[model samples]
Target: MKDYDDTTWFLGQWGRFQQTVFFLLCASVFPNGFGAFSLVYLTDIPSHSCLVPDVNLTQDWHKAIIPIKVVNGKQEWSSCSRYRLDVVRNLSALAYVPGRDVNLTDLELEACVDGWTYSRDVYQSTVVSEFDLVCSDQWKQPFTSTVYFLGVLVGSFFSGQLSDEFGRKPIFFGTMAVQTVFTFVAIFSPSWTVFCILLFISGLGQISNYISAFVLGTEILTGNVRVLFSSLGVCLAFAFGYMMLPLFAYFLRDWRSLLLALSLPGLLYLPLWWFIPESPRWLLSQGRVREAEAILREAARKNKLQAPQIIFDNYHVDADETEKQPKEHLSIFHLLKTRNIRNTTVILCMVWFTLSTGYFGLSLNTSRLHANPYISCFISAAVEVPAYISSWLALRYLPRRISVICILLLGGVSLYFIQLVPQSLSELSVALEMLGKYGLTTGTALMFVYTAELYPTVLRNTATGTCTTVSRVGSCIAPFLLQLSTYLKYLPYITLGTLAVASAFATLFLPESFGRPLPQTIQQMYRRESSLKCPFITRKKPSKAVVLSESKL
Candidate 1:
């Protein structure tokens, strides 16, 4: 059969057919963007303190029940602990002040017997507020995000294989339905435990839909357009969607309403199933020649181009031979089988891990930044637009290795210096943190196209899926990393910065892929040495005259 790229004979590359598919696939990514990070707002811990029960007492006596505790060297009302109820009741009846009538230091402390009262200045309702997920129960907040990411990890591991075995279209539609339905269902979750379980199932479909769309685009498009679509097109859509999330959260105020707003858009995507065609290349690879031909012709007709009467006529291969071909089950193991492949796989996974940690770490920490959470989130998502644009340009013009390294290095440096910004200038600290986020976001966009170019088509999905699965470990750790801020304010930034720097160095071992044809098979990766080296660095062959003179011929 004719190569998929040779479709120029019957259809135009940048014509109606490709653009139609590209935009629709990108539209699907809009929801995936916000869905990935919604936990930041949904589970946010609002200002909370121990609830005081009904009692006839002076205002001072009521104030004495909840004692102030030192946090970060500053005194704030304790959320978890309170003064003994009996002592407080007796003191209130006597109109006693702690320091005046009783020794304040001698008052016994006890855990919050009454449920907490949450401040509703920002959030009207949240899982943290609704379920009292503060103080002792605070651990559950991060665990919720971790559980969601665990689902992503499991989905990423298997989705690619399932897509490869079945058609991309089926997995795409299936996951989209799962993502939409479950996310909406989660709003009515009976308990925090049920909400988390629904979140996990939603998470499962989220990454799978994204990966399915990504692979479909890579397989269907050709040359620079493919790079453009992968780096900027879908990524930009995601960024825009993420930017809108703050507006939703800001207006909704209630977590359940915000979730409903996030999920309701998925209904608009159902019609996409009819518009998107299956990957014709996959059909050909499966020896379904007639089915593949129909798709190509339909594409040509849609593009308003002339048709070749016989599309795969010149291609000659026996159907029996195709059936007899070895059905090798490609797995992540295939990535580690060879020397060069093993080295490449290890480095790529590390790069993915570091990039993801920085991205999610910053994304999740917007609430902690000394600014309006809505504004912080908007700024965070807004920077990704320019980052993605630069990444798209770099993918086209610059060597992939240098592009990734420079972006990551900048991110690492920006993160490292955040601690040096004086607390008096909280704005400067937020700006520096955003600068680091910009760098990491750029690197993230670049890595998607870079990894796709590195792996051959046969193993491309498996490799990308494996790398993304490893990256989820970073995402899963991000919540806990933010939790470390309670111990040392700058710990998460320092940790992410350190990882970004280390991964930049690790990226040096990877070969550059710029203006070179994508590897088609595992064998091609092993046989081709020059294809794998830095494009800007090369050894010069000796000139013929110099060789003759040196030989004294």
Candidate 2:
């Protein structure tokens, strides 16, 4: 029987139909860029001091009311503590000035019980300032990001099965709607709890929309076009959206306004439903050959070509034979049922987890960089454009394993070396951090293409979803990893760097899939063989059955 690629060759790669699907799908992912990392500005903790009410006091006493603590070799007003207001008032009445007649250090300190006066020099307002998520409550800020990733975790868990069960178009648009509606509604949340709950729900749709677009593109587009779409098309769209985030945040400093700006772009994607078609490969897998053929005919028409009347003659037979088996048996457990697949899944999971951790850790930590938060974030998002371009080139030419290893090591080394840069050369530190981000972004873009190529058509969505779901675990931990910096300034970098390098080594175990046809069955999955010269360089040949099946094409 002819495979999906050969069977649908009439559609022509890079034709009008492919171009329409490619651009529209990429456009669909634009909102996700900002939606994923908006929390950076939304939850930012600006410079704040305890809010002291007006009392009969000298200017020195008013300034001295807030305790001073040395941080990083410089004395600054304490954000969380202040001298006792009653003591300051009494001292002022005695005609005694702070540090003149009385030592300011002698005054007792108290928590910011009254409230905090947040500086508006950077952000007009953030979730941290609005909800007073400062001092002891500061933990909630990072936890808020974690909560959204937790939603991504849950959404990724089911997105695969849902996409596979239904068609790709439905799930893609459906999740986009879910994300948009929830994010829009979240702006009106009365409390942090309500906001978090809405964020979690929106997260479910965010990743699902992204994954669905990926799978749909990979399934519909063929050969180099598929590789390009996977590597640059979808990823750069996301990068563009991500880049737009800082621009929006730069203008809209208020958390609610920024969120509302992010939420509104999703509405622009609603028109895409009519333009993007469902994945025909998925249609054929479900024994819906007629529907699949109809889509192909329309594609052929759009491309100004004639498709044969009997497009899926052999495919129909193959689909019917496969349909005899019970559908319920094809669960995620099937991935682990075979040794070759099990090994691939395990290694890929580890790689995904580590990459996700490093990617999001650096992304979310942009606000903390020793630069303007807006510029830092903009630079962070901007770097991804070239990173993905590099990824596209690598995916198109290099072997998958070597690409993964080199990029991972680049990220790891750059991040690990950050601590060695002298404090005086703070610019070098930021440069190393951006370099690390560049490497990870390239690695992340390549992984999507690599993973899609490794799995069979039947299990592709499930496998991709599983890997992303595992990666979300790393994302969920990412915000807290930044929190580690409070104790040891370079802790997050050291940990993320170590994990990236370790995962690079893990990639050595997986078989290469570049220049090989995507497998259609578990039996066709790449298995380790003693005949290969170099594990990383050599691409494994398909089994005899798959070879014979493709020869017929």
- C-alpha TM-score for every candidate: 0.92, 0.94
**What does candidate 2's lDDT look like per residue over 261-297, in tens digits?**
8998889989987889888877776767788889999
Best by TM-score: 2
The positional error of residue 433 in candidate 2, measured at the CA in angstroms, is: 1.4
Point out where model 2 deviates above 4 Å: 316-329, 526-553
What is the TM-score (0 to 1) of candidate 2?
0.94
Mind giving the per-residue lDDT tens digits that candidate 1 earns over 1-553?
2345664455766889899988999999999988987887998888888888887767887877788889778999888988888888888788787778988779899888888888999899998898778888889999999999988988888887787677789988888899999999998988889988999999999888898898888878777778889999999999999998988888899988999999999999998888899987666655676887888888888998877888877654333223322244466777876556788989999999998888998999888674588887888889899999999999889988889999999999999998998879988888889889999999988988888878866577778888989998998898888878778889888998999999988888787778766654454454343245554466455455533332221
lDDT of 2 at 325: 27
Model 1: residue 182 alpha-carbon error in angstroms: 1.1
Name the weakest run of 10 consecutive residues (lDDT summed) in model 1: 317-326
**lDDT per model, in order?**
0.82, 0.86
